[model samples]
Target chain A: MHIIIVGCGRVGAQLAQILSSEGHNVVIVDKNQESFKRLGADFNGITITGVGFDPDILKRAGIERADALAAVTNGDNSNIMVSQIAKRIYNVPRVLTRIYDPLRADIYKKFGLNTIGTTTLVAHIFRSALLKESAKHEFTIGNDIGLVEYRVEEEETAAKESGGGKK
Target chain B: MYVLIVGGGKVGYSLARRLADEGFDASLVEKEERMAKRIAEDLEQVLVIAGDGCDPGRLEDAGIARAQVVAAVTGDDEDNLIICQLARDTFGVPRVIARVNNPSNEITFKKLGIDTVSSTTIISKLIEEEATIGDIFTLLALKRGKLSIVELIIGPKAPAADKMIKELRLPADSILATIVRESHIIFAKGETVLKPGDSIIALATTDSEMALREALLGKE
Candidate 1:
């Protein structure tokens, strides 16, 4: 499997190294040349320095033939843009995006995007560990399915914030 | 209407100035302290807020709840999108406009129900318009085939050059409407002479288009 990663942060670099070591093709993209240092001198995966979401850059990074794409950029918007391009434009079968803001992450999920939020995950885990009953979860679909649900007033907050204007 | 603008870059600064000049309530937010300060040098400080637009605290202080139109024109497409979404989802701003740096993201922005101003699309269109005049240009087309307005330049080697419009055997259905020579508009008439380096705008039918071209260049 060929995987394309859009960031050169720790997670992105480590993921690329691991995936390449596992015998899967890996291509890592970063705008700054310095970020490639994270992948280490022994890394074998391809490293591309350019705007991650640029069509030309993605093409050079093998996005057209990539089996999966992970947008782990620091900015929620950048990650979302990269993910959307990978999904809607290239039709990558597997696309994942990382969002820092939990609210914004939830909103994108409503639009049918696979997203992960670091702050959301950490806070939920912290709460579950500290207080079992204080955990933010709803009933699971079945005993075998562990569905994680957070009690966020997304709909009401959205309607209220629109200040009774056009929904 | 009250307008809240994020990103005090060229677009935001110019738009705020124009809006202020037009007597509308406008405020601008810039994440960079230097940018906000520089913009505040010309505009009122009250109208310029130095803070991250994505932060709800900053948005509330910038009066996002009262913003009728929110335009995020930052350089980063993602930042602009997040700012607009925050304004809409957090404060319920009625109208949210986001600037899209990538043309491919325009469809995604639209699909997510966000109105986007795509700089890539605008730039591409401008380039396309400029290159259209490089060769044969179709100005207008009437119906499906009745008439087509075309513009072409007369080269020095063309046979029609240095000839009077009256002498040229232009088809009955084809008429030379105007001639542009060195930035001057010359109404084409029978006695008007054609010269090299002249842009001719003509109205011709589909069947006569080839004949018009052949007559103008003296070639089939």
Candidate 2:
């Protein structure tokens, strides 16, 4: 798959490495040329130094033929704009973005865009901590559901095996 | 796949519950007998053991050798790290995911070669940001938040269908990730045509999502 990634920060760089390692055609774009240094010399992908929202830069990164686009820059606004263009303008089949603000995630969903907020996941963790006695690990799933992990004791496990029903 | 989670704390218990929900075999080992008993009462399917997570014997008892993944999410960072390493080296678990209480510990975890590290603080900050921002959705954090993959559905009247991918002119910070049509995944490419029913997936920053939606659905 051909993937275009905006932002050369930690998240962007990591994504690029993973995708590139998986044998996908990856192009990474960043405003600062020095950011490419983070990718390292062994990196095997096209690197473009320019603003993420620039038309020419995206073109150079091969957005026209991109199979997927990822906007994970530090700024929320930048990520949203880049994601919009990839989907609306280029008609790229897959578009994903990283949102730091949990509230914006809802708005993004209304517009039919998939979003991830780091804080929401953290909240789940905190909530789990707060309610450690009742539930276990808690993480946000998608919009409606949450993925939570709980532990089973020996007695509970036995009850389950015996069909003892919820205790 | 079976998984072993060390700690009966919130993170550990959460991991157990989630794995069970997904129909995966999971067990928990906690040092506190009371916590273990409580966990036992709460989760019916998970196997709860009262023992030290860092001990090889406890891990073996939890079936770590056969477990696909082991997650150490105790409140203590050092304990989590040690348990994670033991799971990886001594038990030979395929994957180890650890929870970092402090953000600073993340770098050390990375250096130690932990498979995955999640920071509750960072995640909370992001959630707070989302609650306040009002325009983005944070879907999932992968690889310590280095990469995120998200999903979006195209509106029936989206202008995106009218234009070829080469012409839509998307913003720079984002990329069209993939299209799911009737469960089939279509990788984005220049020649790929957008259909009204296509469920799109994308990766981008938080704010640009609106534009991505407009591009696919056309102006709200």
DockQ of 1: 0.21
Deviation in Å, model 2, residue B178 alpha carbon: 8.6
Q: In model 1, what are the clashing residue pairs, if there are any?
A: A161-B91, A161-B92, A162-B92
How many backbone clashes are present in model 2? 80
The structural similarity of chain B in model 2 to the true chain B, as TM-score, is 0.62
What is the C-alpha lDDT profile of model 1 across B2-81, one tens digit per residue?
99999998999999999988888999999999999999889873389999887667888999999999999988877777
Per-candidate TM-score against the hidden true structure: 0.64, 0.40
Per-residue lDDT tens digits for candidate 2, residues B138-201, read: 4675655554455666556767774577788776657887788898988999778888777777
lDDT of 1 by residue, A1-167 (tens): 99999999998999999998999899999999899999998799999998887778888988889899999877777888788778877899888888887766766665556777677666655565554333355322112223354433534221111111121
Q: Report the TM-score of the second chain of model 1 against its true counterpart.
A: 0.60
Residue-level error in angstroms, candidate 2, position A18? 49
For candidate 2, give the DockQ.
0.01
DockQ of each: 0.21, 0.01
